[model samples]
Target chain A: MPPRPNQCSQLSGDDYAESGRRAPAVQIDDVVVEKGRVRILDGISFTIPAGSITGLLGPSGSGKTTLMRTIVGVQAVRSGTVNVLGRTAGSAALRSSVGYVTQAPSVYGDLTVRENANYFATVLGRGRAEAERAIADVNLTHEADRLVGRMSGGQRSRASLACALLAKPELLVLDEPTVGQDPVLRRELWSQFRALADAGTTVLVSSHVMDEAARCDRLLLVRDGALLAEGTPAALCAAARTNDFEDVFLRLIDAADQKAAA
Target chain B: MLLVVPSSLLTLVYSMFHNQPGRFDHIGLTLLAVFPFLTMFLITSVSMLRERTSGTLERLFTLPIGKLDLIVGYATAFSGAAILQAGIAGLVAYQLLGLDTAGSPALVVIIALSTAILGVACGLLCSAFARTEFQAVQFLPVVVLPQLLLCGLFVPIDGMATWLGHVADVLPLTHAVSALDAVGSSSDPTAAMWQDLGIVLAFAVGALAAGAATLRRRAA
Candidate 1:
C-alpha cells in the first residue's frame, strides 16, 4: 500500500517557516515518559533546526533511546508533546518524513540486503529508482542481493541506514549509527550524514563516543533523563573549561552526580 | 507453506476413500481441523517472536506506528501468503485430483482465508502468553490437540460426552469445518455453516482486539 501522504509530509522541507513559526523540524515540549513505575524522561523540551546535525550524548541507561523513541512517536508520552516536522510525533503525517535507524540492525535476516530495502520502500511508498539510489548511497550497490544474515555487522548497519534513507526523510533519527563501523567506513558514513544535512535534512544522532559529538552542529547532553546542557560543541567545551568534548562530558556528568548527592 | 495446503487436501481425499457411510462421511475435514491450532501456535505467534528475538518489538514501539497498525500489517502479510498457498493447492486439486466439489471457488477461498485468519489470531494470543519461541511452540498440542478430539475429526460428535460436545460447539473451527464440508462436498448450505461463519468472524475480530491490547501494554 502507498504510504499515506500525511506520513511523508515531514520528509518535505517546505512549510518550515510558513506563517512565521520558525517551524522546527522536531520539537518536544514539557515531555515526560515512564516505563512501568520508573520515570524515564522528565519535562524535556527542545527543538532540532532544519538541515543541521544534532547529537544526543549520554551514558548507558541515561534514557537516550527512550527519548529518541518518544520523538518518533512509538512510546506514549506521559505528559507534554513531541512534534516532528511540525506535526505530532507518531502522527500518521509525520512518520513518512522521519527515518529512524535503531541502535541494532533492523533489517530482516532472512531477506537479502536489497530485498530488505525493497520491503521498507514498499511500506514507505518509495519508488524502485529511489530504493536503488539509497542502495548506492550506502555503498551497498554490489551487495544488494546478498542475504542480510550473511552480511557483516558493519555491512548490516549500512544496509539499515540505506533503508532509513529510502524515502529521503526530512528528519533522520539514528541511534548509534556508527557503532560497529570500521574507521574508513565510519568516515564515509559521516560524510554521507554531512551531505544529508547540507541538503536540508535535520539529523539527530545518539552516541556515547564523544568524538562523534564533535561532528554535530549542536549537542544535547542527557544524563538520567534530564538535560545536562545544550550548545555547540566548542561552546560547551569552553563553558566547562575543558580541552576536549569527552573531558567536557565527564566533567558535566561528575558535576551532576555531585549535585545530586549534595 | 505447501504443507498447509496438501495436508488439508489429503484429509478430504482420505475421508472419501474411507466412506464409512453416514449422512456425513465424517471424512476429509477442512484445514481448520488442524490449522487454527497450528497457526495459533505458528504463524500468528511469529510476529511477537520475531520482535522479541530481534529486540525490535521495543524499538518498534518507539516508532510512530500504532499497535493496531503493526499487528494488522503483520497479519495481513501472513494471510496474503497463506491465501497464495491455498490457491495453488485448490488449483492442483481441481485439475489434478479431479475432486467433484460444489459451491463457488470463492467460497472455498473464503474458507481457507477464515482458517488463516483464525490461525493468526490464535498464534498471536498464544504468543502473548509465551516468553520464548520454544514456549510458544509448546502451546501447539495443548491448544491445537483439543480440536482433533473436540471438533469431531477422529470421533463422531455423537460419541463425545454431552459436556465435551457442548464445549466444542462454541469453537470457531467446529463451525468452519462444517461450513467447508458443506461447500466442498456439495451438501446444501446448512444453518450449521452460517453459525460457524459467525463464530469464526467473532474469533477473528476478538483476537485482533484483545491481541492488540496485549501487545501494546507489553510493548511499553
Candidate 2:
C-alpha cells in the first residue's frame, strides 16, 4: 500500500472548520453496555470526525471490543445511543454504509479468499469488481484463489478484512486487526488505513499496543470501561509530559486511579 | 454427493435381505420412513454448527442480510438437496429393487420430500441450541430417537401403552410414518394420510419459525 500522510494532523484550521460544518461520522452519548448483569461499558461518550484514523487504545478486557461492537450495532446497549453515519447504529440503512471486522477471522474456511469476498459482496448488494478491488487493496491478490483454511493465520484475517472492505463503507470499525501480523504487514495495513481516511473514510481501530497509537490521527485512551482521554497524540504526550505512549498510558492510568480513589 | 449414498444403501439392503417374502414393500417403507430425512438432518445440523463455532453466523448478522434470508437460504438449499436425494433413493427402491407400493410411486417420493424438509427444519432449530458440533450431534438422540421409536414403524402406536400412543400422536415423524404406511397399504391417499401430511408440514413450518426466533441480531 502506498504511504498516505495522516489527514487529521495535516488539515489547516480553516480546512477543518470547513469539514466541521458537517456532522461527525460517529457520535456516542452516555453509552452504557452490560452483559449478564456486569457493566461492560460505563457511561462513555465520544465523536469521530470524518476523514480521520481514530485509535481506540486500551488493554485487554478494557471494553474496547465492546465499544467497537456497539458502534457496529451488534452489541445491545443498556443505555444511551451510538449514532453512525448520521443514522442510529446498526440500523438497516447503515448496514450498507458501515464495514466491521471482528477480532477473529470470520470468513468461510472452505471457500477461497476471493470467493469469500464475492460472497460478502453479494450479501452487501455490491458488485464483483468492487470485491476484487478490496482483494487488491489488502494485497491478497496472489493468495486470492487459495482456501482460507489453508492460508496462514495473518492471511486468513486479511481475507476477512477484505470481505468487510467490499462495501467500501463510509465508516470502518475494526477490532484489533493487527493482533498477530508481522511488522511489515502491520505497517502496510496502517498505511492502507491512512489512505482510506485521507479519502474521507472514518476509521476506528482498537489496539492494546501503544506503538500503534502513534500512527493514529486521533487517540482515545480507555481503561476499565471508561474513556480516559481523547486528543491528538502530540497533545496527549504534552499533557503526560512524555513522548513515549507507553509512559503516557501509565501516567494517565495512575492519574485516573488517584482521581477515582479521592 | 447426491448419487453416491442411495446406490450404496441399496447394495447394503439387497445384500442383507435376499429373497425374503414382501421384501419389496418393507424396503419401500424403509425408504419413506427413514433414509432421506436422517441424511438431511445430519447435513443441516453439522453445517449450521460450523457456522456458529467459526463466528461466521455472528458476522453475517452484522451484514446487510435479514434473519429470514439466512434461515430460508439454508432451508431451500438443504430441502433442494434432499429432494434430489429422495429421487435417487426412491428410484433405487422402486425400480431396481422392485419395492412395491399400492399408491402412485410419485406420491411416495413427494411424502419423502416433505418429511426430509421437516428433518431440515428440525436440524436448523437444533443448531440454535447447540454451541458446538459435538453438542449438535448429541441433539439427534434427544430430538430424533424418541420420534423414531414411538412413530409406529416397528410396533404400531396402537399396540404401545396409552400414554406412549398419545405422545406418538403429537410427534411429527409419527404422521410421516403413518402417511407412508397408508400409501403402502391403500391404492388411494386416504383422508387420514392427508391429515398426517398436513400435520407434518405444519410442524416443519413451526420448527423453522422457532429456529429463526432463537437467533438474535444483538446476541451477547
Candidate 3:
C-alpha cells in the first residue's frame, strides 16, 4: 500500500526543512525563454520552498505557462537554468518525482477515467490501487468507468488531475487547474492542493485569477514576462497599501512601468 | 472494414473484366501489397495526430516513459491490427476470390504483414512532422503518392527511365511489391525475394528510429 500522508514525515518535516534550507523544490535562475523572436520569460529567478503552495499569478499571456513549463523541464530556455528536486529540469531522473498538468485536459480520451489514471500510475511504477485512490481523491469514483472523451469539461479536467495525482509526486505543477470550474469544486480543489502541501508535496499552481492568490503561501505576481513582486498575499497587499490583490497587482505593474521609465 | 470493402469490390470488378484463370492472383497480389500499406499508414498517422491534438502525448512525455516505449507501443498495437487486417484480406483474396499462385500462400501472407508494418513505421515517422490531422492526411499525397507512382506498381521498374528506376530502388514500397511479385511467380521464396524483404524490414526499422529521434514533447 502507498504510505499515508501522516506516515510520510520524511517528505514533510525534518529532512524537508534541511532540504528547504539548502535547496528549494524548484529553482529558476536568470532564466530566459523565447518563442520565435519574442521573449516569453525574461531573466526570471525564483525558488519555491518545499512543503508549501506557491501561486504563480499572472495575466493571460504573461508567461505563466511558459515559466511552469520551464520548471517541469518541457519548455526550452534560451539561457539560464531551472533546477527541480536538485536535478536539472527535464532530467530523466526527475520524471517520476514530478507530476504536471497542462492547462488543457490531457487524459486519454479513448480510455476510461480509471484506465487513464491506472495506465499513468503503471507508467510511474505505481500500481492500480493508487490509481483508484487518485480517482477517489479527485471525486471521480462515480465516473471511473466512463470514457474521458465523454466526460464533461470539469470532469475531464478532474480526470487529468487524477492522472497527475496517481504517482503522489513530490512536486505537483498545475497550470490553471481550476479554470472553468464551479466555485464549490474550485474550493474543494484548493483544499486538495493544501492537503497535498500539508503532506509535504510542493504545489506550484498558476492562475490568472487574483482572488486565488490569497490561498497561496507565496505569490509570484508576474506581468509581461517579468515578475513584479514575490511575497505572501498579505505581505504584498500591505506593501502596496491595499487589501485588494487586483489593486495591489495594478499598483505593482504601475511601479514597474515607472521604474522602466526612469 | 472501410478499406476492405472498396478494395475487395475493385478486385472483383477487375477480375470480372480480365476473365483469366490466373488473373485473380495478380489482383490479389496487388491488393495485398497496397491495401495494408495504405490503410495502416492512414490509420497510424491519423491516430497519432489525434493523440497529439488531444494532449495525451504531451501528458505521456511528462511521465517516466521513454520515447522508445511510446513508439514501440504504438507499433505493436497497430501491428496487431495490421496482422488481423492482412489475415482478413488474405482470406478474402485466396478463398473468396480464388487467387491462384505457384508460390507458397504463407509467403504472400508474410509479405502483406511486412507491408503493413512498413506502413506503421512510415506513418509514425510522418506523424512527427505533422501538427494536424489534415496535415497528416496531406502526407498521403506528398509522401505516399510519389512512392506509389514510383514503386513499380504500374510500370515495371526495369522499363522505367534509369534515374526513375534508381528512385524506385530506394522506395520501400518498391521492394515490398517486388517481394510480392516474386512470391506470386515462383514456387519457392527466392534469394531475391529474401533480399527485398530484408530491405523492406530495414526501411521499417530506420523509419521507426527516425520517428523516435524526432518525437517532441509538444507540438511546435
Candidate 4:
C-alpha cells in the first residue's frame, strides 16, 4: 500500500520510471470520495508521472470526473490523500501551478472569450497579452470576441481551456476537453495535449472516447469508481490479447465484474 | 429595482393620498423601510445561486483566492449596486415626486444602503443552502417575509401580540424601519436611531461571516 507509481495492475513496467526521471505530478493513495450516501471515488489509487500526457478513460459516470476533481483539490475525500506537486492536493500553494478545466464551461456565459480568459489571467496576476496567447494556444483566436454562451459547445470548452492555461500551470487537469468537437478539432486538441506534455506540463485528461486513449503516453483505465488498469496503450491491449482498445476495455470490465462477483 | 420600486411608490401611492396632510412623509418612510431589504436580498441570492450552478465557485476556490476574497468581491459588487440604487431612489423621491422627509435625504439614502447590504449578506448565506435557482427564490418567503411582516410597517409593535413584538425587535428589517422612521419625523436623529443603524449593520456583518463559514470545498 506504500506509494508505488509503477506497480499498478497491468503496468507496462516501462523505462519511463528510470533514474533521473522527475517525481510524479500527482500521487493519489487509496483516495475515497464519498458525497452524502453514495461513494463517488472508491479507494482509487494511482500516480501520474511528471511531464506526461495521462488519459483517464472510462465510460460516463465511472468516476473519471470525480477523480479529476479529486486531483484538482475541490472534491472532498472521505478517507485517503491526493498529493499533487509535492504538497497536499488543493493546497493554496498549488493554485498557481495547477490548471483545472471543469467538465462544465466554468467561464461566464455573458463575457466574450477574451474577457473570460483575461479574468482568469488577472486572477493569476497576469494580463490581457497572456490571455490572448492562451486563447491562441487553444486555437480559439477566431472566436475570442464571441460570448461564451453564444458559442458552440466545442468553442465554449476551448474558452474554458484557454482560461485554465492562462495560469501556465505545471499540471493541467481537464475533464473531457474534446467531448463535443468535430473529428478534425479533436485531432488538433490531441496534438495540443501532446505539445503541452512535450513542454513538460503534466496533462491529465478524462474522456470516455477509447480512440483518444491511444494518444496518451499513459492511461488510467477506470470504472465503477475504481481503477481497472493503468498502463501504456500497447501494454493494455497486449495484456487483454487484443489490439483494439474497445475490445480490451470490455474485457477488463468483464474481468473486474468477475472479480467483484467473486 | 432601485429606481422603479421607489418611483412607483411615490407616484401611485402618494397620488392616492396627496390630499392628506402628512401622507407624503409616510410614503417616503415606507419606501425606505422595505424596498432595498427585499429586492437586494432576492437579486443577490439568485446571482449567488448562478455562481454555484455554473461551477465557477469551484474554479475560484481552487485559486489562491481566500474565502474572504470571494465574500468581499461579491459584497463590493452588490453593495455598489445597492448604493447606486439608493441614490436613485432618494433623488426620485425628493427631487421629482416631492415625497418629503424632515431629515436630510442623504441620511435616508444611507439607511437604505445599510438595509441593502443586510439583504445581500442574507442572500449569500441562503444561497449556500440552495441547490437550484427555484430553491433560492423560495427562500425569499422564509427569509424575507417574516422580517417584512413583523417590521411594524403595517401596525406598530405595541399593538402586535407580545411574542410577535419580541420577534420584530430581533429582525433586521425592524431596525431598518425604526431608523427610517426616526429620519422621517425629526431633523436630528434620536439616540435610538443610531442604535438601530448599528443593529442593521451588525446583522449584515454577522450574516456575511456566516456565509463565509459555509463556503466549502465539497462538490456543489
Candidate 2 per-residue lDDT over residues B1-220, each given as its tens digit = 6556765676577767776758647655755657667777888889988888787887898888999999899989988887788888877777777778888888787888888889888988899888888999998899888988888766878899998899999999888888988888899999998998899899999998998897787867
Residue A67, model 4, lDDT:
91
- Per model, state how many residue pairs clash: 9, 0, 0, 0
lDDT by residue for model 1 over A1-262, one digit each (tens)?
6543212111322222331244678888889888889988988888877788889998899899988888877777889988788787877677678888888888788889888888778777778888899999989999999998899999998888898888788889999999988878888888888888878888999998777776777789998788888877766777777656668888988888898899
Q: Which ten residues in a row have the lowest lDDT in candidate 3 chain A?
A: A4-13
Residues A1-262, model 2: lDDT tens digits: 5422322233333323444556799999999998998888999999988878889998789899999989988888999989898889889888888888989899999999999999999999889999999999888999999999999889989999999988888999898899889989999999999888778888999988778887877889988788999887877877888767788788998989999999
Point out where model 4 deviates above 4 Å: A1-20, A260-262, B1-5
TM-score of each: 0.83, 0.94, 0.92, 0.93
Q: Summarize candidate 3's per-residue lDDT along B102-129 as a digit string, tens digits.
A: 7988888788788888999889889878
Query: Which DockQ-derived CAPRI band holds candidate 4?
Result: medium
DockQ, every prediction:
0.26, 0.74, 0.52, 0.58
> All models: lDDT?
0.74, 0.84, 0.83, 0.84
Please give, as one word, the docking class of candidate 1: acceptable
lDDT of 4 by residue, A1-262 (tens): 5632222233443534441199998999998887778888889889999988888988888899889888988887899989998999988899989999999989999899998898888888998889999999889998898899999888989999898988888999999999899989989888988788878899999887877777777889988798999888778877788767778789999988898899
Better of 1 and 3 by TM-score: 3
In candidate 2, position B60 carries an lDDT of 90
What's the true lDDT of residue A189 in model 3?
95
